[model samples]
Target: MQRIVLFLLTNLAIMLVLSVTLSILMSVFGIDRQGLGGLLMLAFVFGFGGAFISLLMSKWMAKRSVGAYVIEQPQNNTEKWLLDTVKRYSDKAGIGMPEVALYQSPDMNAFATGANKNNALVAVSTGLLENMSQTEAEAVIGHEISHVANGDMVTLTLVQGVMNTFVIFLARLIAGVIDNATRGNNNQGGGLGGIAYFAVVFVLEMILGVLASIVVAWFSRKREFRADIGALEKLKHSQESQLEGSMMAFGINNKSKFISLFASHPPLDVRIKALRDSQ
Candidate 1:
């Protein structure tokens, strides 16, 4: 619940900041409100800017949201192993060593996130460590390392930015059209129409945001598969079973179809089959 609240608050803050920044930009440029080209440009600016800014803050947010503590010095055997495994993979992947951290969660889940491959965070839940074998845990780490090496985070952000651009542009355009029609019908050119315009834009953005999420989710699913393959290639051929088993564990334990359309990972069975077939 805290994670969800933090996510929401972060997004709201980003939107508020972008709104203020764009307003300033529009005023400084003397951009005509009626110009489609100017509006489109403005949309892209906020769209991409917001996405990148979120990426920049992702590591900090993850740490706070999950109470993840980065292991600067290995305090125990498990911590030492975690740090050593990550460094081994990081060296092989040719990326800067990522900050390794552990978070407390009862679910077997791990994630990799950062602004770039060179500066990333690989965090695993304590539940995952307790549940999975050392081999399985390493496999999970490999999957995250693959995400960094392949630049999945940056690519995902770009895709999100593009979707955001279109969502913003189309929502405003439709809202303007509706507002104009409402004004025309009332024969009053200005008064309450601004209110209607904002209301309509908000509703449309909500609806469009859901649709956009489906698209983003689809890309996320694909990337999961790619990350799996990347992980296999990084690990030994003998560790294939461990890789597949770890994925299955993640899938079965964390699987939920309630909001599958917006899920970031593919179904567990599908992922397992993909890995086996690759072998």
Candidate 2:
């Protein structure tokens, strides 16, 4: 629940910041946002621009979000093991060694994030270390390495950017049509026409935004499965039992049971079944 709230709030803050910043820049430069071409330009800027911005800031954001610190030197045997595991899997996955960090979370959670595959950060929580066995932890680390190896962050960003562009473009286009139809070719602003245009836009933004969220989430879920497979393939001695065990650990907090569309990962049971079936 905390994670979900943080996710929504962070995104909202990003959108608000981008909207304000871009609007100010556009106004200062006398950018004419008054035509199909202009609307598309605006949409692309707000959509793709936001995704890229987040991508570039991903490592920084992920670190802060989880309060994880990158291990510069192994302070202990556990930290050394963590570093070694990440390095081994990363090598197998054919990516550079990602900076590994540890966060103070009691829940079993870890993630891979960065601007790109080669330049990435992988962080595991202290809770996971305390709870999981060596093999389970290896599986978890392997899964994160796979995410980096597959460039999931970059692909996810592209998917988000495209979805965002279409949502913004379609919302404005539909709102403009409705406004024109209602006002019967009024070339003025304010009053009912302006109100209707904004109202239509607000409503459509909500509707389209939800739809976009679903699509982005679906893509995210699929990537989770791919990353799972990638992890197994990367593991030198991985077996069916290892695959099943690894994902079950990863899916301990899986939230996809009820809201599959909005859920980022598939249900735990489903993931386990898939891994076993593939092997």
Per-model TM-score versus the true fold: 0.82, 0.79
lDDT of 1 by residue, 129-229 (tens): 77667887788888889888999889989998999898777877887666566564455665235446555666676678769878987887887865354
Task: Indicate which candidate wins on TM-score.
Answer: 1
Candidate 2: list runs displaced more than 4 Å: 1-10, 17-34, 185-203, 226-253, 256-259
C-alpha root-mean-square deviation, each candidate? 6.0, 6.0
Alpha-carbon error at 147 in model 2, in Å?
A: 0.9
Local accuracy of candidate 2 as per-residue lDDT tens digits, 150-209 = 887799889989988887778777876666655533556532354455556656766787
What is model 2's C-alpha RMSD? 6.0
- Tell me how far the alpha carbon of residue 174 in candidate 2 is from the true structure, in angstroms, after superposition: 1.9
In model 2, pairs of residues that clash are none
Worst 10 residues of 1 by lDDT: 239-248
